[model samples]
Structure formats: structure tokens, C-alpha cells
Target: MTGRFAYGLRVHGLDRVTDLMPAPPGDDLPEVTIRQHTGPRPVPEPLDRWRQVRLLADGRHLAVDRRSGTATFHGPPLTPDLLAHPYLAAPAVVVNRWTGRETFHAGTFVRHGRAFAVLGSRTAGKSSLLAALAARDVPVLADDVAVVHDGGVFAGPRCIDLRQPVPGLALPGRTAREGSRTRVSLPPVATHVPLAGWIFLSWGPGPALARLPAADALGRLAAERSWPQLPSDPAVLLTLAALPAWELTRPREWGALEATCRLVESAAEAAAGQPA
Candidate 1:
């Protein structure tokens, strides 16, 4: 099936059905074709200086051609969850990077028609926080990678991967084991919302929010960027830095999640000029 993903990418040749909808009418988005290889995986070769063939942990072989905008997957049969993630999501980001779009290793949620990107380290509970927000009726745009272009955050796959089930948080749709994490599928919600601000996650004694200076925010964002080895567009980073940012520190306790969610929602609402 063909579907549209973040960064205006029309991905074709997906083996399993996905919640990702087709592009809106008359919208011209870049196309990336996925072709399944049934034979032995080819000897991996670099597509270019920027693209290389990769073998995922699950024995999936991925190869991307930047010039032609195509990704070839070969290996064991893929489940729906795997296809949506490393297969489709990985290439989509690569295509976006090739086209000069900026992507961050962050989660994003929508509040009051604006998006706030939650930036954090790998174990910083970014996905956990997003799952918590999802449970609270907040619209999560993307879980792991938030694509930014022209100051708008693109909607990502309709799912979130969690290390384990969050207590008292139940999401609808398929639930399955994806490696070490549980993949919770969500309903389709494609929205490209204007980014309102950034929220950096940190651990502290209690829940606290502090506004970050532009310089400080810039450094944190840079550290959480996807494909940092590649050159970044200074203009894009500068523009994002200009947005309102805060360091959200909270006690690392599951019991603190409720208060943490409230803080995030309030901050997002406040940024959107809505009464918190």
C-alpha cells in the first residue's frame, strides 16, 4: 500500500496496510518507492556518500537510493509494526535529510493547534511522556523523530514504541512485541501544525519548568538532532532556537507522571496563548 509520511513523503510499496493516509489532493510531495527483495540480500554497498545499505538487528536489509528516492527491504518477512517503523520510518527520514529538511530525535504533541517537540536523551522518557500525553487525549504528532520544515512539524506514523506498558495508560489499536519494546498503534491523525515551542526533558527532585535562553536551547536541540554527522542548516536551527523553550525536570517516578503531564499540557497551552 502507498501512504504519506512525515516530510511530505509519499511512500509506495509497503507490504502491510498502514494507518498513514495518502497525501492531500493536489499536494506535491516527494515519492519514495519500497521494493521487496525475495532473493539473498545483495552485498551491501554505499549508494552514495550519504546513503548506505544497513542490516537491522531483526535481519532486515535496507538500502536507500537518494537520487531515485527508493528504498529496498530484504530479509525475513516483516510484521506490520516492523514495516511501519525501521522500514518505512527510517527511509522517510533519510529522504527528508537528502532534501534538506531538519529532523530531531524527539517526540512531538499537538495542543491548541500547535506542536511542541519533546527533546531528550535516549533514556529520558520521551516516548513514555508521549504515551502519557496520548492517554490524556493529547494528539501525538510523532514519537521518536519529529520532522520540521518551514517552522511546521510533520505528523509521523500512527504509533508509539514503549519499553513497557505504562501503568494506567491504555491506547487503542494493535499491540505487539517489537523487539524489547511494546508497540502501541494509534489512529491516523495527520497534521502539520506550526511549532509552538520546544520542551527538553530532564530528571530532578520534582517537577519544574525553566525557560531556556536561545543559546542554551540551541545546544540542546543540536545534541538531539537526527543524523548529526551530516551538516545542519544553521538557518533552520536558529529559527527553532528563536521559539520558546523550557527545561522540564521531574522526579523519575511513575507516580509523578500525572503531574508531569499536567506541566507539559499547561506549558503548551500557555505558549498557545490559552489559559492553562
Candidate 2:
């Protein structure tokens, strides 16, 4: 069980192999150990205030003890895709939150050297847009969960799981079906990249990108956080909100995807030049 890195944490005890980033040279991120429950499903301690537990409808169980940096999973054997997603994803958020970091339900893409988080609701085509960006040689830090700490974004699993395959975009990697979505593995990225700005997805009759005020951006980010019930560090959220943000709206038609990608790239380039 070699330790693997993802979302700024060194993960240990995963039985199934997943496309996780390698531990960097002289890595010093906090560690979270994973283990399997063999006996009766272990019950969470009532007095453990930092404990977070979730039992999925599919019979999978996940429990994260933030104070001890341990995560336990129980259920059927996990595929790489499953291990990389809900199993690892949920616990990552909990551990980060307890360790003075913030987690968002957003996809992250990179242009030049900085990362931009794409925020939207579940059906907002985030993964699809990431797939499009990947096809154009843009770097994707994380496709589903973006973790932030110390004004930087941590790279997550090296894959994007799309609900449906994007038409005419052939991304090279191992492709497999993961439940209702198709998982496409991608090349690994650096452990961390400087946070740049944010892009919010929306629908409209025409494609447009409009800058958002700090207050509006903060509200949207608060709403799209990973664990709303958990306590968050207000200072970190406020700092992230102060970064540049924009609302990106486009038509729903597939033909608009190309133009939308162009808009995002252009906006990122323009924003990169301004003072932070």
C-alpha cells in the first residue's frame, strides 16, 4: 500500500489502484490513511466531534476522522473509478476542512501557470467543458473537486468523468464506463498551482462573460461548497472571494461549446495580466 497524493494530501491504505498523483520530492502534506472494515460495520464514536460519516445508497460506507487523519471504507470491492471519486472525494473535503483548507464542488483548469476554478451546479456541463479544454491542450488540475489552501489549488485525480462523451473530441487516455458517466484518464499535473480566478457557468441566448463583484462571487462560492454542514474558515473564503471572478453564459447547443471554450481561455489570459 504505497502512499499516493491527491488534493494536497498524501493518501495511504487504498486497496485498489487509482490514477492519483505521485508524492512530490520532499512532500510535506498531511497524510490520511485508508482502511477496510472487515467485521461489523464500525460505528462512529458519539464524542468524536471531528468525525464525518456518509453511507451511500449503493451500500458503500465512508468515514473520516479528521483529528486522526484516518478514513475507512466498507462495502463491495472498489474499482479505480469508484475509489477515486466518492470514496476519496468526500473524505478529502472533510480532512482539508479540518486542516484549515477549503474545498469546493468545482472543476479546475490551468492556463499559463495559474489555475481557475469553474463553479456551477451539477448539470452545468463542467466536466464536459473540461474535456473540451483538455482536447485543446489546456491543463486540468481537477475535474470535480478543487481544494484550496494558502492561496493555491491542489491537483486532484488525473481524470474527468463525463456524463456523456463530448462529440468529435477524442482525448487520449484510458476510457471506461463508471456508472452513468465515462471516465477519461489524463496526464498528471503538478501538486499545486497558484489560484487565479473563477468562472461561473450559466445558460443564455448568447455567449457572454461578465465580471462578478466580490460579494456576488462570495455568495456563489459559499453555496457551492462541498460540505455545507461542516464549519469553514471564513478568512480563507473571504480571501478566495476577493480574487477575480466572472459569470460565463452560453447557449445550450453543442455548437456553442467551442466558442465557450475560447471565451474562457481569452478571459483567463486577460485576467492573468491584471494585478491581483
Candidate 3:
């Protein structure tokens, strides 16, 4: 209630304190809800912007109204990541899309004064590299979702989901019961920093970063599956057009995170020289 988390919106029921920045507060009832499911059939297509309720056979129900900034969820009794829609990127993306903002599945950090992020496949080591950067004093802006507003970026929670113990970073106060992976925590980013650079991560390419054309960056940024479904094609495309992007490859060998961090930092600096 006192601090914020995802989407920078003040949240209720998140009493346990972590270093993550709190979302902005609102005096309304929780805009999100997840609990035991009740019987409700899938909603058929209706007028534009009408509430769309999707019911799954697994006793789950999801309803959204982007125009109204409302979302409702009902899941099976034991679902651990209850606020998956919000804590994750989908719901927030929906709202952002409605508001003409673009979104991406990426992890962002601040260098000097500007912010930069890495967009890539889920297993592309975004979190691990970000962990290494944070350990070295780079402030993490958003863990998974990067909300692109104009040419800038808004950070999400400071927490990240880690598969194994991050050596240099401290993972404190376990959050959700994410299976196999442990939810990692770090101090919240105090403010949203302007995005100066970004990189696309992949497995095969060299760990070196190469500049990319706008066409390529647009296509790749839109293609990642881990990112939420694009709500408006026009808005997302516009955001992509305004940002500079590059392709960054992950090293095949072990223990290259530190080296990669240095390489990416160089890339961010190089990008800052170009017009956004």
C-alpha cells in the first residue's frame, strides 16, 4: 500500500519491503484481481473496446478493458504467480497500448544519466547480465517490461527472476513461489531515465554488438515472444522508429557475463552519439 512495484503504480498487499521502486499510488480499489474462478463463458466479439473475457478450460478467466484501464483475472486455486498479468508484462502492455505507448520484453539500466536496455530471447541472459551490471553499480530500470513513452523509458520492478544464485548480487526476501527459479530482488530504481541505447540479444552471434538498421530493429523488437502482444501496430511501430537499436550476441562459453557487460556498455555509449 505504501510503496509501488510493477508499472510504477502504487500497490496494495505488497507489505514485504524490498529495494524495488514503488508504483505511483492511486486511491482506487486494486485495479487487478486474481482469485478462485467462478463459472463464466468466453465473451464473444462485440463492439470495439468492449470488455473481452477469455475463459480457459483450466479454470481461469481473463477480462480486460484497456479504454477503462481495468483488468480482471480468475485462476485455479493454486496458481502461485497470482498477479502474473500485472507483475508480468501483458496487462501493463494492454494499458500502454491503449494509451499509445509501445512495450518490449527487455531489461533496462542507467549509465551515466541515460537509460539503456537489452531486448532478446527469454534465455538470452538479460537478467544475468543485468545482475552483473547492478553489482557493478549500474541501476536497473525495469526487469522484464520496458514501457516506451515518447523516446524515453519507464522502469518496472527492481526484482528479477533468477534460475540460479547470482554470484555478485544478493537475492533477498523471496517473493512469489515461482517454480524452480528463485525471485531475485534489488533496490528500486529511483526514477525513470531516458533510454539512450538498446541491443538485441541472440545465442549464435558473437558477443560483440553491431549496429542495426531501423527496419531490422522494428521487426526484431516486434518479434520477441516473451514480449506482450502488441496492442496497436501503429504505436509500437512509432516507438521503434524513434529508438536506436543494435544486435548483441551472448558468448557460448561460461563466465563471460562480466566481459559482456563491458561490451554492452561500450555499445550504449556508442549509441548515445547518434541522434535518437
TM-score of each: 0.89, 0.91, 0.78
What are the runs in model 1 whose C-alpha is more than 4 Å off? Answer: 38-51, 55-61
Task: Give the C-alpha lDDT of model 1.
Answer: 0.80
lDDT agreement with native, every candidate: 0.80, 0.83, 0.62
Candidate 2: pairs in clash: none
Model 2 TM-score (2 dp): 0.91
Give the Å shift of residue 16 in candidate 2. Answer: 6.3
Q: Which candidate number maximizes lDDT?
A: 2
Q: List the residue pairs that clash in candidate 1.
A: none
Mark the regions of model 3 whose C-alpha exceeds 4 Å error after superposition: 1-5, 8-20, 25-48, 54-59, 66-69, 77-88, 167-179, 225-230, 233-239, 273-276
Error of 2 at 113 (Å): 0.3
Candidate 2 overall Cα lDDT vs. reference?
A: 0.83
Residue 18 in model 1: lDDT? 64
lDDT of 1 by residue, 1-276 (tens): 346554467777653456565555554677788777778896666545556577666777788877767788888666656666645766776788777888888889999999999999889999889999998889888887888887798887778888877888867634554466777676666568899999999998878889999999999989988867556889889989999999999988899999999999999999999999
- Predicted model with the maximum TM-score: 2
What's the C-alpha lDDT at position 207 in model 2? 81
